[model samples]
Every structure is written in C-alpha cells, then in structure tokens.
Target: MRAARLRRGLAMALTACSIVVTVAAAARSTVPGTPVPPRLPAMRAETLPARYAANHRFITESEHAARALGDEGRAGVLARLARGDRHFLSFSPRGDGQVVEVLGDLAHADRIAVVVPGSDTTVDTFDELGTVYASLNGGARSLHAEMRKLQPDRKTAVVAWYGYPAPRTMSRDIVTTDRALDGGRRLAGLVGDLRRVNAAAPVAVLCHSYGSVVCATALRRMDAPAESSLSDVVLFGSPGTGVRSRAELRTRVPVWAGRGATDWIEGVPHVSLDLLGAQIGFGTDPVAAPFGARLFPAGAGSHSDYLRPGGLPLRNIALIALGRGSEVSDD
Candidate 1:
C-alpha cells in the first residue's frame, strides 16, 4: 500500500512540471518576433529619453489628447510631434511632447493671429475641442471659416500655438509659467521664421489662460532692436503675465486685455515687477486695471467660453484678425 502511494505522488509531480513548461512556452510565443513594432520605430526603448523613466506618462498624455479630440484611431499626434513631423501644422512640438499648430497662409498673408492655448492642451485636445465644442477650437477653425465666409478673397490664417508645458491644474500656474519661458523662446524663433518667409505679414499673438505667461516671457526676452513686428498681444482669462502693468510689458506693440464677468481668473492676483525699480501692478480684476489694454466684453460663463462659437469674445478676435479694431463693440 505504501509503495502504491509513493508512485501516485511521483505521477502528480510530473504533471505539475509539464504544466509549468507549457505555460512558459506560451508566454514566449506571445512576444512579437520583433519586440518593437515597425510603425513606432521612434518609440523604441533605445530612442526614448533617459529622463522619461516613466515612459508611460508620455503614452498616457498622448492618449489623453487623442481621446479628448474624439479620434481614437489617430491617438498618436503627440507621439508624432515628438518625432518632428509637421503633418499636424495645426500642432507642432517645441520640446519633449509639447505640440503647437500654425494656421493661415504662410506667404503674403495680410494678418496673422497666433492663438496660444492653456492647460492640458496637447495635439489631441485640438480635435476634441473642435469636435466637442465646435465653437471653441480657439474659435480658430470657426474664425477662419467665418473669415472665408465674410470675405472669400481675403488672406488670413490662425495659428494654434501650444509650445509650452501647460499646468494640469490652476494650482500649478507658477510651475506652468516657468516651463512656458522655454516655449516662448521657441515662439520667438517661429516669429523669426515667419518674417523670413514674409516680411510684410502683420503678426498678432492672442494669449488665453496660462498662455499669457508664455507670451509675456517671449516678449520680455526680445531686445529693443529686435525686428519682431508683434503688433498686438491679446490676453483673455489671464491669471497674470508676470508684469505689474501692461506698460511695463515693455513692448512698443499694443496690449489688449479682457475678461468675462463670471470668469474665475478675475479672482487671481495680478502682481509683478516692472523694468523700472517701481512695482507695476495689476488688480484682482483685469478690467479695472490701469493697463493700456482695451478691455472688451466677455459674456457669461467661466474662462473656457471665450472662444466658443458665436461668442462675443471670439467675434472680437475675428475683428482684430481682420484689422477692424474700431468695429469691436464692448459687451
């Protein structure tokens, strides 16, 4: 009886070993013959940045942008931007995974408006904002579409510049601004590139939310003799542009500021130093501030509604783009 029990135990051990071997073989077979897919050659292990120890963060951010735009199939826009392809001229990368978009005509365009977006903005957000909020594509597509509708013969284009790493939340405004300086430098480079392409093109930068910070940093870095013909810099839903007052921004260019009555950003503190030793200051309310900027009327809603389709702020932007500044009416 004892001999029979020993034989049975040996048989069970052999079965268990066989099962383990089979599972190991199956796991090996599941791996691709080429571990890296041919399509995503740039995303291979060796090519990834050493700093991105959390490589998954890049993938997550890309997927978030893609899903936001409602285009699950083309979720690789941010990834592609990292690879330096301009297929998404509406979105291009400056560094890391930050993407920007340049719209309108590249040559001989009468007016150019660069729309800098804020937080959580990735290449994918462009599509999502366009798809979900048809009015909010920074009013970019709609603004351009309306321009075409109003005057088919006119030349105009809107650039969606997301050249900086935007804060995921308002709490990170300071952190976001720090990174935006780098983006601002890149934008200044783009300005040079644009001038080289067309010296006669009039340029304007429309900064929204935290984008105002990026524009402020860019303008600050410009020397007085620089040929950057940035005619107008408009800020909407701005927390602060790191200047005590609009005049302290030190640009010969006109600075435009506006905010909706219900906008939460109005509550943010607007305090910064000026070129002079004096403390140039902005108020809790941008509309009430002494900045030389022309305050336009923003309708009801939080900060995100300025560029909504059919909104007053967007119409004002369209007016600015068309060079009809006097036509802009206050809300």
Candidate 2:
C-alpha cells in the first residue's frame, strides 16, 4: 500500500513537469507584434506614515491607461480606486502584470494583512467577474471587512499583492520554486518598504496555494527588522511551503496552517525531488503534525473558500491578522 501511494505521487509530479516543459517551449516562440512588457520607473523613497508621489503618479497613469483602452471592467475597478483613499505602492501594465494595492489606510493602520495569490492570479483577473482567481481582489476586501467588524475602532489594512507573475497552470511551475524565488524577493522588498512605512505596525501575510511557497522563501530571506514586525503568516489551502518544517522557514514569528475538509490540495502528494538541476515538489503537508505549524479551524470548503463571506476560515484569519491570536479557534 505504501509503495503504491508513493508511485502514484511520483507519477503525478513527473507528469506535471513534462507538460510544463512543453508549454514553456511553445510559449518561447513569440508572435509578431506581441505587446512588449512595460518599463517601470525607479522606486522613490517614502517615509513611514508617509506617501510616495511617484507611486500615486503611476496609479493615475494606470487608471488613465485602463480607461483610454476602453476596457470597461478594468476601468470600473480603477474608477472605484480613484474615488477612494486607496494608497498604491506600485502599478504597472506590464505583460507580466504587476500591482500592489492597499485597502484601508496603510499610513495610519496599526495592523496590516498582505494576501499573496496563487496560480492563475493576475492584475487582469482582479475584476474578471466569474473566476475563483477574481478573489485576488475580493479576498482582501472580505478580510478587511471582517477585520473591521470585530472592532470598528481598530485600524487595519489589507494589501492585494499581484507583484509576481503567477504560473498560468498548476503543472511544473508550481512543482518548482523558481517563480517562488522571484516572488520571495519581491515580497521581501515589500516587507522592507512596509518597515520603512510603519515599522511599529504589525503585519501578517495570508498565503494561498503556491503563494505559500513564496511566503516561505521571503521569510527565510527577509532581514531581521522586517521579520520582527511581521507578526503572523497564515497558510490556507497550501499545497506545500517548500520547506520541511516551519523552523526551516527561519522566522521566530508565529506560522499557522489550515485547510478545509473538502480542499483538493489534500490529495496532492507531499513529497519533494530534484529534477533537471532544480528542486521540485515541496515536501511535507503543512497542516500535518510533522510540519510544525499551529493548526487553526478551517470549516469544510474547497480551495478558494477560505475568504468567502462569513466562512469560518475568514474569521480565524482575520483574528490572526488583527493580532488577536487568543480569539482564534483550534481545529
């Protein structure tokens, strides 16, 4: 029985790699007049409880670009953003897709939650009405709303980080840590920027699916000050964090993991291997005993169900983000 399960796991991982290689090769053949990636400007310095004029300028430009292009769906989201006190850390209409939007006032916020999205998520999908990845925008809004409901006086913010290009499919891109490594560096830079923005404010990162791998990498590389201020990290519906144990994540802060009973990620093999000179397939299930993370109560729901309105997972995640750890429920 053990051998059979192992074989099945190995087959799944290999199949994912082979399919990804083919897709990657085909993608390399570029078509004529394919739009080139956007060139972003240099980042400007901004103080904590401070604002960057450069970022705001980029936001205005991006909003104009969306509206000028006659993309109603994209324009609508930008229109809403224009009316709000939305503080944009960065924005670029690159083919790679990049955006860092903050809901609530980060300048005055005492607590912040950063949501790192998984595969198939992109700046374009933020307003894509019907897909699960649309939550790339909605999920943060739900979390921010739930956090406020607990105590309206508490100042909190939710950041939807679409800075890294997510893998288009769940095949080899996920099995490898290459993208996660890039994402990790971006995450680290964000954390560093946040520290400069408000070092005293507590920050929590909510990582989903492949995003968990990105979070783990960031944790391992982030400077001590940035790590110190990041109070918690919640991994929900995570396939694997690419680390064998939470301790391997190299942060003293609290690391939490949760999964709904119906989450399909439970079926994925929790194993790792080295293939073609790259470490593939993260090992050890995060919610399992050996992964060494605090388990939280996540009600029965499938992948993408964690941040749904009124879900148990949303509640607990908010508590963690709010630094009200005592209020979180154990599974």
Candidate 3:
C-alpha cells in the first residue's frame, strides 16, 4: 500500500512539471502580432513658448505704431503682420521673423499642407490679407476651410508659414531670391520635423506669389537623403522660381503650377539676363504647363483670388487636399 501511494504521488508530480513546461513554451510562442509603433520626436515644452513671446513683442510694437498713424499712415504700414496675439508670440520661436502657425498634431496627422505666403507677408497680415480685399480674397482661413471640406474624414493641418523674410515689394533684385531661399530652408526644416513626428503622413507644399521662389530655391539646394517626404508642390502666380526648367528643379515630387490669365505676374519680365534686363521668358506657364497639376481656370482676379470661396482655385485646392481630382467641378 505504501509503495502504491508513493508511486501515485510521483506520477502527479511529473504531470504537474509537464504542465508547467508546456505553459511556459506556449507563453514563449505567443508573440504579439502587432507592429511596434514608431516613436515621436520629443518636443521641448519651453521651445515653442519662447518663440511665441518673441513674435508677440515684435507684433505689439508694430501694431502700436500702426494705430498711432492715421489713414494716410496706413499706406506705408507694413503689408505683412504676424498672426498671433502677444501671448502666442511670446511662446513661439523666431524663424527669420516669419509667421509660423501650428494647426494640427504633427504626430498623427493623415495629411499636412504648408502654405507659404508671398511678398510683403508677415505674421500679422497672414489672415487679414484674405478678408480686407473682399470676401472673395479670403486668405488662410479660406484655405483651411476648403481643405477641411475636402478631407472630412482624414486629419488635415495647414501651416500658414511666413518664415522667410519676403520682399516688401516686387523687385528684380537678388534680395528676393535670397529671402526665398531662406524661407525654403525653414520650410524644409519644418517638413523634416513633421516627418520625424509622423513618418506615415503625406506633405504638400503650396507656394503662393514670391513664396514659390522660396520653394524652388529650397528644392534646388536640397541634396539626396534630405529630399524625401515631399509628395507634391504647387505654385501660384509665380514670376519665376529661379529654375531654368521644371526638370531643373530636380524633384521627383509632382510640380503643379497655375496662374490666372489676368495675374500681374504674366506682365512681369519672366527672366533676368544681363543684356535682356528682364526677358519675356521661357518655360511652361504653371496653369497650362504639361506638369501633372490639375489646372484651375482662375478668371480675371489676378494673384489674389486663389483662395476665394466658391472659386475654381479654391475648389481645385480642395480636391488636391482630399486626394481626389475627379471630384472637382468644372465651375
């Protein structure tokens, strides 16, 4: 009886050990099927706040000056103004004294659009430029509204970038090109940050007016390994982007160009050769150009009508944002 009892106990012990071993093996085999999520960049809390403060200080001084001056004083007042109030400016970082508005979560956005404004644009003037001329001349708000309408399901963000020191006026001088290049670099950096924060998102750049010049310059200067993440580039009412040809821009990214027939840029000399002073020009008109951009038939409104509500330009932009050109109405 004693021997039988001992045998039974040993048998039970062996069974328990086997069960433990099997459970351990099962646990080891059950690895997670989901992918390890990508890490986001560590954004220092202080960095953005500090930048905002500087911007506020600059804008406050300018606004006070403008208020002191009468209606006649408004004529010479700076065309561009920073976007934020004193608190916003106080927290933001200064990048070439340009305006930078962060609209969405850079970490998980589905789509990102960067709107680079043109000549005489500053942080303050960013929004007003659209409203002052008429309801038809809507600015950043119009662009944002159109984008949201187009991409209702996806996370979309628009950056009203006034980062480059734009020319105060239209000038043939090299300063215009220099300022554009500066803006482009800043844009490139911003793009890099966006990508670092969310590698899966697509980024599109809309360069308006002289901002196109900056975009072109940045593309030309960007070397290999630094050029990815840009899915599309659109230029509106651009005189020139400093590239002799679209191919010279050296970007695999699709280039979209368009200008209203009545755009003043058409009248400006297209090229600057020493002997020609400013030549009529060569290369394709962005609107009619062979490049794959969806051409919007902007009527006689010139450079400023691109963002007007219910307009062809805004509709086309909306289509681009939504990733569907087929939805755009001809009207």
Tell me the TM-score of each prediction against the true structure.
0.66, 0.85, 0.66
User: For model 1, where is the 10-residue window of minimal lDDT?
Assistant: 31-40
Q: What's the true lDDT of residue 88 in model 2?
A: 60
Candidate 3's C-alpha runs over 4 A off are 1-96, 130-138, 170-176, 223-226, 274-284, 288-296, 326-329
lDDT by residue (1-331, candidate 3, tens digit) is: 6455445434433343344222223323422321222232244333545545555555555445545544223323333334353222111112213346656544567877777777766434544654643221235557767777766777876666666666555233222355665667877776776666566778788788777878877787765544677777878777667666678788897777767767887754443332223222223345545434455555556788877776787767656655564554556
Score each candidate by Cα lDDT: 0.57, 0.78, 0.57
Candidate 1 displacement at residue 38 in angstroms: 16
Candidate 1: segments with Cα more than 4 A from true spot: 1-96, 129-131, 134-138, 170-176, 223-228, 271-285
Q: Which segments of model 2 are wrong by more than 4 Å?
A: 20-85, 129-134
111-161, model 2: which lDDT tens digit per residue?
Answer: 989999888775567644264433677888889999999879989988899
